[model samples]
Target chain A: MSSAALVELRDVVVGYGELPILTGVDLRIDTGEIVSVIGGSGSGKSTLLRAMVGLLEPAAGAVCLFGQDLYATRPRSRGRLLSRVGVLFQSDALFSSMSVLDNVMFPGRKLTDLPDAVIQELALIELARLGVADLAERMPQEISGGQAKRVALARANVLAPELVFCDEPTSSLDPINAAVLGREFTRLRDDQGSTVILVTHDMEMVRTLSDRTVVLAAGGICAVGTPATLERSEDLDVQALFHGEPTRESQESKRA
Target chain B: MDVRLDAIRPRSLLHELEIHARTRPAVLRLDLSALRQIDSTGVATLRAVTRRLRRSGVAVELHGATPEVMRVLAETPEPDPPKHPPEPGVLESLGRSCFAWWSGLLTLADMVIEAMQGAAGAVVGRRTFAWRDVVEQLELMGADALPIAATMSFLLGLVLDFQTWVQMHYYGTESVVLEFVGIGMARGFAPFIVAILLASRTAPAIAAQLSTMEMRQENDVLRVMGISPVRHLVVPRLFAITLVTPALSLIATASGILGGLLVTVWLDPHWMAAFETMLREMTLGDLWLGTVKSVLFGWVIGLASAFTGLHSGYGALSIGIAATRAAVASILFVMIVDSIVTTLWTMAQ
Candidate 1:
């Protein structure tokens, strides 16, 4: 991984009204690395990601994306900064009014000067990679939840953004498509040097694909290291987390 | 609490178990050691018996299952509890409903008030409206609505005139029907009909669209991208609907008068005499009153629809419920405000 930071959180505090879920969260994400953020449900995984992605500004401290403070900058400059980032929200926020293919092509067309044909071709390839190519012509409402998640994932990566934030990209996916997503993220990093911030509970994906995993619990990051390193750590909570979430089969595979 | 299960008996075998379990044993154990044969019906009956007992706070245990019975039990999932939890008591339910209704009203009021602030902010800040969306909404709420409003108002006028003429013709005062039709259309019927038509047609559609977008979190994406969903979505439609409602009411008023004119031309042989009588009886205040009512109804429909939509719960079912609430609340509030306005105007006079 490159030493230059793509995103930095400095003593960040964020939460809903009148209560803080994450406090004094400090971390750095570098270029060309896939970082998986794993935590139990309601453990502030999505909240931390939201603060980093410019949706919820921190109550205190700083969130620096591409070396610029996301909230402290001018609105026009913030737009320019956000244009380089892509996000797949937990709800799979595909454009309900547009066909699936149009949704995948949206960011490329809006953020870049890419030709329409090129954008369409790129969108098709991304969709095929995620096993949602056939559903491209369908509207968001017509597809199943898994299909919508795949379509949303394809759209997020279509722009080959400098930074990508995906929340539970494989939660609704079957094993086959989820594996495809793992490979797609690898391709995104190897081919485009894109940095990915994956917030998910999919331990299998973390085991296979992440360069580093950030274990969030008790209001801040408890452990941050390679998955294998964290798996064998001395801390009881970290070992229990790695052991608890994955299946018995994954545990056997890890031993082997 | 070990209850022996020997064989599959027919009627009331499970019934006896259900009745026996009514004493609410802390634990009921079924020992299947002596069971030889069991069919699908027997398994289903046993499942239902276990389910009812469990629901009533009994702990059911199956033991001593032979290999065959074990295989049968493995294939079938343990009976699940009811999907919906039990309802609260009557008073509790009523209290819950009242609290929910009041809370929902408060939330809706906050959203609409914030939107009004945004609308005012846009004008003061000199921001440009999304003209394309505004034009499309204007076409939908005003121009496309024109024919329906005209036809409905015209038919209403025709019925009123014909009914009045039947009695007035005998008194040789048939022209007096024109006075009633003219004043009624300009002051009351035209505005009320147009308000109802737009409320039923456009308000629900707006709520559905906004709620769908909300469920999908599309606005959150826009917010993340440094754009306001209000600027991109809400203000444009509000601008158009607010501009169109009064204009459509004016057109509806003219169409209703024309319908009365058709009746006059068809009945008495002299068209000029009856037309002159209707014109002389009409006042500009009547037209202005209808316009004012249309303006009030327009804002009520727009704000109420937006309120339900922005506060809609997540998912398809909730979106549908919000749209229905939009139509009903808009119409109810329109009449309440109309009555208030009319009564105030009458008292002032």
Candidate 2:
């Protein structure tokens, strides 16, 4: 891949209230790379994603997308920049009243000047790609959890954004569906040349999809390398994450 | 060579740059003195063009950029603004509130139009209306409310008759008691009381139902599906209320007249003469005016309840708050409509 950084986080410090989640963190992601951010609960994996997506402002430092500081831009300009980015929320966050097809079509209808027929055709194509075109007319509530996730993925990727952020995409899926989603992510990168940042706990997913893995611990990046390298990481926290071992701090806290 | 740039809109600037780069000058200097504003897109376009040109072994330099353009290009991060905006001054707040109320009213009016169109479509057999939903709401807002409405109207009539009888007895005008009760129950008490009862009872129920839908994001689903929630969820309830409320009011009027008759008969053995006098004094105009007012009251209550419910915030607590607001707003609207209708009818008389 070319040495072009699609996303750059320079000493980004993000927190809620006074409690810091991410402190002085630096990272760069190149175009067409699938990066996985893996950590235990409350390690601020989601917080980092939110900060990168402009949903939450960092307490300090900068998150630059395509060489422009995201939060430094005017609100309107920020919104326009955000159109080139797609996010798959943990909850799926599908509009419950709309049918699956309509949910997939929603972003395109809002952001593009495409005609209704063309938009519909595109939405159907996405649904067919995800193998859920038969469930297109089904309401979000009517679909199974896995189906909902797939539908949400289709919706997020429908805009064909340059970057896609997937938050726990495989957390609630069955093994078969999880495998399907992993393949889909790989397909997204290969076909669309889109960079993906996946936040997940499923180590199997990390092994299957991520070109690189970032291990977050103690409000900072503990290690970042390929999944194979991370599997062999010497850092105790990184080892604890990969091997499911309790680090000294966590064990001490448990005793306390 | 200097190339001047003007009106560098972010949306189109990238495309414009590609067209400019087609000439492939060995040395390109962009003069931005004419640029009044530069957005994030404009900045991004410049960066992309610079990178692309650098790869192609062409020299590029930006010159004559104004301070504003320079600031954006520098990507100097500003301190984040306060999370919550500063509170507006009192007058400004008032103006904002008035504008919000006016905007809300316009939205409600628009929803009402959409609902009416949907209802009309149902009537003309062009669209399918949820007959089952309308029936369910009718049972809830109309049939279930009958007992309380009847009891309240009966007590109201008894009190009116007793109070009027005592005063008339002092003047030896006790014979007018039946006429006074009949005219008062038909013209004012029955429709007004029934409307207030429904506003308190049915409005909250509808509001809670819709607010729960909102909380669950069901309303959002409808919006995403390109279906109007007002037309789908609200029109049925509005129609049911509009059709059933007048019937309930008529029942209230009958129960009230019966209660007054019972009181008059108990007070005097020769109550038949008073009954005949009341019949002679009662007019169709009075009955029709009360019916019209009841209909208007029903429409106002339904509209108010649905409006508050559909706009409710997320969660169970928000649903409860929305229900309370809907009830209070519905009652207030009913009273206002009642007052205006009564005044207009009185003036016509």
Taking the candidates one at a time, how many backbone clashes does each contain?
A: 0, 3
Candidate with best DockQ: 1
- Candidate 2 residue A56 Cα shift, in angstroms, is 18
Model 1 has a DockQ score of: 0.39
Tell me the tens digit of each residue's lDDT in model 1 across A27-67: 99999999999988888999999998888888999999998
* Alpha-carbon deviation at B338 in model 1, angstroms: 1.3
Per model, kept true contacts as a fraction are 0.49, 0.02
Model 1 agreement with the true structure over B54-173: per-residue lDDT tens digits: 889998888887899889877876655568967799999999899989998787666666567667766675433446677988998888889999999998888888888888999999
State the lDDT of candidate 2 residue by residue for B28-71, as single tens digits: 78888888888866776677777777777778899988888898
Candidates' DockQ values?
0.39, 0.04
Model 2 residue A92 CA deviation in Å: 8.5
How much is B171 displaced in model 2, in angstroms? Answer: 1.5
